[model samples]
Target: MRRGGAATRPSLARDTGLSKPTVGQALLDLEQDGLVRPAGRTSSGPGRTAVLYEADPAAGHVLGIDIGRGRLRLAVADLAGTVVAKVDEPNRCRSASALVRTVHDLATGVVAQAGMTLSDVVKTVVGSPGVPDRGGRMLHLAPNLPGWGRRGLLDELEAVLGPGLLVENDANLAAVGERDQGAARGVDVFVCVNVGTGIGMGIVVDGQLFRGAHGAAGEVGYLPYGWTDTDSEGWTPSTPGILEQAAAANSVVKLAKEHGVRNASSAREVFQLARQGDACARAVVEQEATKLAFLVASVSAVIDPELVLLVGGIGSNTDLLIDPLEKAVREISPLSPRIAPGELGEDAVLTGAIATALRAAQDIVFDRRGENLVTQRSGVNA
Candidate 1:
């Protein structure tokens, strides 16, 4: 009934392979529990009309929050996956504590706008820039947000948002968003390369997120750069990881400055100039695209994904980057993984978080069957 939107008793029985009496009894049980309710009647046959049943939207709601470096995005969805309210705001808070408070405020505000309170939300999923600690105590590898990876941060967030809250990596969530609603739909194997304030990859193999052995499978920032020159006269270890130093947003600005694009102050500006036919800015963009192409090629040589979804600020400019990027990748490697911009755009993380919450809340809203399947699938290896 939930998957098909609505079903009559006969249809339900036919789909479930259950006897008619058993289907009737199950529908009665679900209706009594307030999880499923009847919609308008439908006549599949010529004789009589049958009542259609669907998962009740009023039973519960799910909340999804995306905590980005510069912006905070949120959405509220009913149990049946309809978005009721949404909020997008600048992240003005400088400290992690302040950011947590902002999240609580925005979450409650959006739910209130949806004609509900925090009590009405059965599940909440927060997409932040880091690997979620399975112990549910801290977030790892989120260096852009100050104090984000401190010990006991998850405990602090849970205290503010109440129980039934799950924190997930934003990049991984973007990949999920693409898989569930964007370009990667029906794709069994793919990767999402997110280029925003930082660089990260989300690997989906066999239609599942592969977080590697230590919950860091997609942390491509640490990928080696120029390490083949083993006997270099001058090689220095830097704080910024290899991929980050060479390919992140800051690197775009640095490369533009090195190429004499004196007026450029940001990657957005550099891309804009390139689009306007500025030689220096175009060179900068090509350089950045070439480096990102190398990363794509490297990932292809390993996982050999069928498609790669580019996301975030850099990825949004697909019109300018795709041609040069594909050309460079073809020249560098024999592998030709199809690359394209993600459909969800900047809201991919929030959309994925909502999808995650909907999946988790659906289990609890209807019946507590066995274990928490969502948590089990996302924990440790999420």
Candidate 2:
């Protein structure tokens, strides 16, 4: 079933090196259980056209949700991994309770748009900004979203979304999304650097997602830049990390202010001004590019990945920063990892969440083919 496309019984037998009778019997069982359905017949060949079998679209459903500082996105997909509906909205909720209600409403609406209900969803994966602690009780390193790091938050989410819900770091999901379908496809070792309102990284090594011992492997925003531990007497513990404070959206606006660019509220506005030949804005962008280049050098010096994918709202603006970033990195480091804009854009996290949910749903569905039968059946690698 990992083929992800329809295949005939004969093809399945050939691919798995199983007998035709075994493949036929497995397909029959899956069909009877409503987990597999007949697709159209194959093109005419030597003798007769063979019917193709595919995972049943109606047998199971999954939901993917991306909860970000500025927006909330949701997508509904079926057992076959086809996305049927998607929705995005500005995130105005200030409190955790409001965020939970919003998530439920958005998920319900998207599922309804796909002609299904929330109860029909077999698994749900949420991509967010922080890593859950060892006990899965609280989320840490998510200062942008107020009231999100409190204890018992995961329990509250599970209570509302059911036991099949999972929470993952948004950047990690973005890397998975890219690896599965976007710029990082087939690249074994790469880094996805997401620069938006905040900064983070998603590391993939040896064709697998590498979450460090504490599930905080990619939290590069904490890298010390302008700030140091000896000068931390007046710094707030919850303040934005050093590198993030120096390079993210707030820093852009701060740099703009220092250079006398008036009335620009957002980084997007700053970039626009830079494009219009504003010298101050241009300087700010140069500084941002230089900081990002230093970040890339740091990463390249450590892991030496094959590629680096720049994602998120500010990072994806390839027209403005790509050239400068490349030049800066080349100047500072001997290692040269190809840096490219994320192809999936805003949908990367949602796509990744859906992909993860689909895999989990498939595992559950296939495991239900009777425990003994799944294990004893010849060449049935379920």
Candidate 3:
């Protein structure tokens, strides 16, 4: 519905089999309200150049917030889905109320940087590490954050930011973000899996994000499968369990202790040691890759997506994952989906939030077109 990105009304009408007059009228309605504008005249043919209209990139602004385990991000974007400004900082709040307040303050600063106000902001989208209710508030069971699943969280957000705000799972937003303006541009059905301090997935089907009943469809981190002692045929049972629990940056640090590799503080250091031919580090990475491959295989069997987009701090590093992950999936499934690292890097979720807000606002105009046509037909009959 947001017309700025691609295609024109005349071309759209031809594709939809609708009369040019109908399309022109719809375009006029959208333009009158400062939503879309005449960008320029098309140079196809001679008589009269048709004026091309696009969604006005400056019509309104949107704010996106991604709250992670130890960090918080705030970004302001235009209708063109371009991030205009952003802020990232470590969260110092200990309670949900304090976090909400901090977010509100950050939003205010972001808007000011964008040379706008809350009234100029069409909407705000927040992405957290847990499932949000249908109404887009109150995270339910975000294990990374203590006491996050309590009730009234939505009410609190509304009370602080006003209303009509959207809250989404970070992985879900990452998936949507990738499809909208990131690596999975033409992919309609794909799963976006983020590997970081924790693991999670976002499912996109039929060009729309598929949020299951209760809004927690892609919770792959707690898939409940684990590695056991002793090798069993093709699969190594005793190697490691879920990659997030065993190979995540945090997990790698924890696993290092068991190997008597003391004073290793970060996942980066573990990878560095592996490259240096440290026995313990190579074992850790291989063990992690094997577990990840199994998880990818399971996801492929269930989703059968065209592609599986890997993201987050760990998944984006294709140098470390692509080969082993591909091999693992091929070992079990014949129809393995193409695996690729995230293209948008860390900004995928932020970009997705802006796209989400723009879609909601633009859908308003498209929804009215159908109703208006029906009314006109009824009037003509009368």
Candidate 4:
């Protein structure tokens, strides 16, 4: 009853492809283990009235974390996907070591607020920037946070978070979040483009994340824009590409200042002034949109995703960016996909992390209840 709760034995048997007797025995074992409990009887079904069962909230817990350069978000949920507690705080730590410690402390604190401890968290998912290596250890090209791309990043996190830990790319989690409950609900193929202090893309194809061969599928910031052969010669695996430097939030402020948009220190102010009809600020925003359009065009030409979700601090301003951005994409290439704003706002990564954690937690909780030794199953089924 992890998904569709409170089903009859026949319904459960049909859904799981098990015999009615097997489903009955499995339910008994799960009830014995306290993983599931009767939730009253069904009253209005076609067949005779039947008893119903649901997942017990006491089965286990899940913890999800979103670590960004600016803020750290944490949430704890139960077996039913209900959020128990949450914590959102600005990230003041400058070094990776400090950040790791802060995450550990915050995780513990939130779990405690949820009336639990670390041991109760059956699964923990962390959403972070950068591409994780094949070993799921070191993060690559994570320049926004100081000293994060170094090796042993996951080792440190695992040490604190304990087992059943998953560290995923933040942008990937955003796309997952959008798919689970946000804009991409039924979208089979799409990309979530995150634009903030840095830029990244997360591809969802056929209802799943498409991490390229080496787990670096959606590193769009590394895409070449203004790089020359000389620039390529100096580039390394850890170095971010010209696209991020020229198209990200910092570039917005720089372009705004160059265009004589006075007192613009951040991209937010530029967008605000543009909304207020400041000609120079609007010009800066238009340039930014064109850059984003070219980036979108390049991506659309390759994968041809059905939708492009613009997210993050600068990207969520779809009202101002969409018209110009789409027009520029049409001008740049014929392969233009429908572009839209992300529905989850700034918390997309955290929402994704929670959903992923809940999925894993629910799976483990139910699958363990169904698992039986061959001998046990033979006797029980008989």
Off by over 4 Å in 1: 10-29, 44-47, 227-239, 369-382
In order of appearance, the predictions have TM-scores of: 0.88, 0.90, 0.79, 0.90
Candidate 2, residue 243: CA error in Å?
0.8
Lowest lDDT 10-residue stretch of candidate 4 = 369-378
lDDT, candidate 1, 315-365, per-residue tens: 778888898999999999999899999999988998899899989888887
Global CA lDDT of candidate 2, please? Answer: 0.87
- Residue 258, candidate 3: alpha-carbon lDDT: 70
* Candidate 3 RMSD to the correct structure: 6.1
In model 4, which regions exceed 4 Å deviation?
Answer: 9-29, 44-49, 228-237, 373-382
Instruction: Tell me which of candidates 1 and 2 scores higher on lDDT.
Output: 2
What local lDDT score does residue 240 receive in model 4, on the 0 to 100 scale? 64
Best by lDDT: 4
How many clashing residue pairs appear in each of the predictions shown? 0, 0, 1, 0
Model 2 Cα lDDT, one tens digit per residue, 1-382:
5345889988888887877888888788778877788988987578889989887877888999999999999998887778899999999999988998889888889999999888878899999998877495878999888899989888888777778689999999999999988999999999999999899899999999899999999998888876666746655647667888889988899889999998789998999998899988988888899999989999999999999999998888777898899999999988888999999999988888998898898777665653345345654544
TM-score head-to-head 1 vs 2, winner: 2
Candidate 1 residue pairs that clash: none
The TM-score measured for candidate 3 stands at: 0.79
lDDT of residue 11 for candidate 4: 82
